[model samples]
Target: MQTASFVGFIRTLFYILAFYYIFKFLAKLFLPFLLKKVVQKAETKFQQQQQYRPDNSWNKTTTEQEVFYKPPTSQNRSSTKKVGDYVDYEEID
Candidate 1:
């Protein structure tokens, strides 16, 4: 079996660092283009949805609905019951 050497270790480290930098550089170049496309697609989808949505103005009628409310009668009024006693507390410094 071959043994680990300093040269091999240095070569592996160099490869890893090179790959990392290359990937980072490529991402920086392409990420914005990808993000812009995604945003444009989303915007188009939103506009399409807005266009397809039914207009609320056409569905609304000019007729006014009258609402009537009657006050509670004395027979329907509930009696109040005492539930608990209140205790007053003084703060001590």
Candidate 2:
């Protein structure tokens, strides 16, 4: 049977920490370039799509029209109606 050693554990931990820092450093250096290229590609694609689309000249109207909305009014009544009865409750300690 084999037992776990302190030196092996420490070496593994050191390797993990080193890899983390190296990856972080590399990401910082390369992430911006990757993001910028992606953005430029998306922008070019958007421009090309816009160019292929038809103009919205038909949507524009020469005359402007006003719109009016009237809400429904309720009738006045003297009597009041109850929907439900109120229940009284006591809390026990």
Candidate 3:
């Protein structure tokens, strides 16, 4: 049977606490700088998108007119004459 030593247990607990505080300190130091960079990048991308988008005011006036199509007039031909070209053939017996 193995028993855990009190000194080893206390050392592990102290190590865990030290790591926790170190992580908190690093996060506090670096997190805002990283967040500011991310926010600035997002803002620049949004501004670029806004700059490239077409203005809606020009489109608003043009959308009211509906287009009507007028097809070209064609000459009327007899249906029988236009059906198909005649071809001569013989039935095989």
* Number of the top lDDT candidate: 1
lDDT of 3: 0.91
User: Residue 62 of model 1: what lDDT?
Assistant: 73
lDDT of each: 0.92, 0.91, 0.91
Residue 78, model 1, lDDT = 75
Error of 2 at 23 (Å): 0.7
lDDT of 1 by residue, 1-93 (tens): 999999999999999999999999999999999999999999999989877888756666878889899987768657588778898999999
Model 1: pairs clashing at backbone N, Cα or C within 3 Å: none
How close is every model to the real structure, measured as TM-score?
A: 0.55, 0.65, 0.53
lDDT of 2 by residue, 1-93 (tens): 989999999999999999999999999999999999999999999989877778755565668778798887887876688878899998999
What is residue 40's positional error in candidate 2, in angstroms? 0.8
TM-score (C-alpha, index-matched) for candidate 2: 0.65
lDDT of 2 at 33: 100
**Runs with alpha carbons beyond 4 Å of true place in candidate 3:** 56-93
In angstroms, give how far residue 45 of model 1 lies from its true place.
1.0
